[model samples]
Target: MALLINHCPVRWHAIYHSHWTALQYDQQSITYQQLDQLLSALQRQLLTQINLTTPPSMVRLACIASNGIELLLMQLLCVRVGWLFCPLNPRFTATELSQRLAVLNTPYCWIENEQDADSLPTSSPQLQIDFELLLSNLHEQASSSIAVTTNISTSAITLTPLLIEPEQACNIIFTSGSSGFPKAIVHNYRNHFFSALGSQRLIPLASQDHNLLSLPLFHIGGYATVLRTVIAGACIHLTTYPLTVALLQQHRITHLSLVSTQLIRLLADPLFNAKQSAIKHVLLGGSAFSEEHLTALAARGFHYHLSYGSTEMASQIATSDNSSQLQVLPYREIKTHRGEIYITGETRFIGYFRDNAIHKIAAEEWVASGDLGTLKQHKLSIIGRKDRQFISGGENIQPEEIERVCLQYGRVKQAYICPTKDQQYGQRIALFVLFSDSTQFDLDCQQLKHYLGQKLISFKQPDHYLAWPLKLANNQALKVPKQVFLDSLSKQGLT
Candidate 1:
């Protein structure tokens, strides 16, 4: 029998313990009862802190920490207390982090420790708390006889656990911001609840399943996995990065979420043998999958599904069926206007949070996804990002179209096409490729150009062939920052 999700509304008599495992990290496994106990205790301490300073509704808890039990618990605590949980990427450099914090203008920021807080540029005056120390204090207080409940309740707290509404804003996620500074995307509890339900319609999650927390909590995919597990009463295995096949087998992970880069690394890992994997279902997203990667998974008999989504829609808007055609998932609507994708539905985010307020989307307004795609017979095929399309010699050129052909050439491992200023064509295509091997191919630029000519029209063909940028070649990010490539081109006098 499945365990009950504590977040769901329930009758007073229906609340019961099931002893089902809720979380597993390393050797420690936390059951549903234990998880509820921890959250319940943490709630009082958190409430006391909030009541002492900011009201719960006005609280914007911006957290900078790695993925772990502590981070996950904080997310749950925010949900229970009706605070907007803003989890920033800890891997970002100090400058990057400070810039993001400035945009948020958040009232409170939580860091792992004092060292982490000291690293940031203190241009803004926001309350910074040591989250690890806060957790330790909570643990200490829980063991003490001092009644913390009265500390918060006696203070005339404006927010209470019972007051948390599903319609209230709950999460703030920053976009990748390949072109500019990341936008703060806000999601309500209803968005997440429907996102999980929509994904469950295509990808079934059972109580017996153990999903690997492969993605970070900063990304929508990672947070969605948490809720998906909760809604299914399943277990989420929280482990460190570089997930090995041994760990998968050890944890008995049944469901996995991965991006294209992670999938490639796994396929290349000498320790990875597909037949030995305990992973039954793999959900792929983040970017477009190459034909090479797809063929590799297919040959290995991997039951992988492709997903297309964004932070605005919560997580997955469409999931691939058995035939691998992306079909619109439940609770989300996808339509094309002049070949550009527009989205709206129950799972759509509230809006972009900025300037200390939510810039909400008008009711029944469709969000322009900035993605160009084609829909045929209820199946969607993503062409490319609309912003990435450039005009060359009065003809439109989509880099993805050329990149797709380059990947099909068999020698290219990854391909990216960017626009460069051209004296003759106004804007010309520049192709950067990562060969299957790190070394350059025997075929020179002329040969590559000749090959592309056969596959693409002369106007769409790249005028410049260059090696992949060194900085991005080693990037572990799910999506390559296109602006970085533009910078590289500027340095090389190509733009």
Candidate 2:
């Protein structure tokens, strides 16, 4: 029983720090106290616009848009009023959106515009609300030039902005998994509370510091930033524009959240010097990364905090502050069972947002991380996903192991490997790779196969080779959809 650093009770929404800057989205900004007022305004607007005469105990709101001031407002409103805010990726197709909405049982879906509304199933159960109109009205009414939100009525409803405990559910985020099903992970106030606590203990952020939110809000990476900055009393730059060297310097961003791919791109840019960039911290979270790049950044005085966390864990279970080794943070315990990582802690996610309620977890209470890793001296190094393992002929094959070897080659930029059916071996390995942009390094199938052949055993080596596109989702961190990958293979006649 030790006191946690910066540990404090959960404040559903803090109305006190009104003058201090809380958010920096493009040219606009909002203070912590102003944020509280805006949420209240938006709550009144939700009350007037939506049908909630006999609202159920659990009310769910779905948002289809990129990150913005309005989306942040919706998120905070739900958090304060005990509503579940679900953000759907605008990249999802009509069928994808329809299927997910049905599962969510959502009565409200706030879309970016008319075009986004048209993209969703017109006949779906969820009522689509024009968020832009709401924002316009709010701006016209509010005196502060925080862009359109003052018009939002402050009329109190029966259910007020109640103080929610740490354990109460705050948000439900849908994450793409290997199971090929829409798994909505439920996170409570505590999950975020301690996650922020762990990160600050590792690398603290001050109120004057700014963290650039480059990840999508729908993903846990993006959601975690919101909670982290809020808890630290630090300002957040919520811009939709892609992170660039000029942009980072222009915004005077001290902290940033990025995946591995983004790191590589920054490394490639001659203007992005680790020592000169002035970025104090980079919260590295994602699937793939290289030690050479990490070492280079470290040598140049950059602090890349490698973290291993997921939607179920609310974010970072382990993080490396100054060193490359990821040390497990306090408020959580990390143990391995048969080489698989399992997390049990106050910050772990409550459960999957399932239908009805059998409120059961798999096996023991500890959440199975489904990741293979080595824990030594309380530090964890994630090797690969256990579910990513496949059998080739008779021997077990880990595609990530092969991909890791391929990444060592100077020309290889990105990689993806999966099992393709084979009668002789039961299953065979196939690879789709992207080589570094270079005229001299003209990588071909045979050349890559030859490079990997020396590094990997024949069984673990890929039997087939396909092209990897330069642009992938938000980075290599987010895996491509199963069907999308299959269709790409089919189109290339590689399947």
For all candidates in order, the CA lDDT equals 0.76, 0.72
* Range of the 10 consecutive residues with the lowest summed lDDT in candidate 2: 150-159
Task: State the displacement of the C-alpha of residue 307, model 1, in Å, after optimal TM-score superposition.
Answer: 1.3
Q: What would the per-residue lDDT of candidate 2 be over residues 1-495, giving only the tens digit for each residue?
A: 222222321122233333457788787666555566566667777776566763432677888887888787777666666677889888778888887787777667777765667667655444444556655643454455533222222221222334454555778888775666768888777778888888887778887889898888889888888878877777889876777888898888889987767888788777787656768898887766666677767777777788888788887889988676889998878899999998888777777776732143542478778899999998888878898888878899887788878877766777778788887888898887777654534356668788888988788888877666435634434555456566777776656
Clashes of 2: 7
lDDT of 2 at 78: 67
TM-score of each prediction: 0.88, 0.86
Q: Please give the distance, in angstroms, between residue 400's alpha carbon in candidate 1 and its true position after superposition.
A: 1.2
Candidate no. 2 TM-score: 0.86
List the candidate 1 regions with Cα displacement exceeding 4 Å.
1-17, 52-55, 123-164, 270-274, 442-450
Could you tell me which residue pairs clash in candidate 2? 138-148, 138-149, 138-150, 138-151, 139-148, 139-149, 142-150
* Model 1 agreement with the true structure over 158-265: per-residue lDDT tens digits: 322233477888889999887567899999878888888889887888768899988889888888888888767778899874677778778888899887667877
Q: Tell me the deviation in Å of residue 78 in model 1.
A: 1.4
Candidate 2 Cα outliers beyond 4 Å, as residue runs? 1-16, 50-57, 122-162, 356-364, 438-450, 470-477, 492-494
RMSD of each: 5.4, 4.8
**Residue 64 shift from truth in candidate 1, angstroms:** 0.9
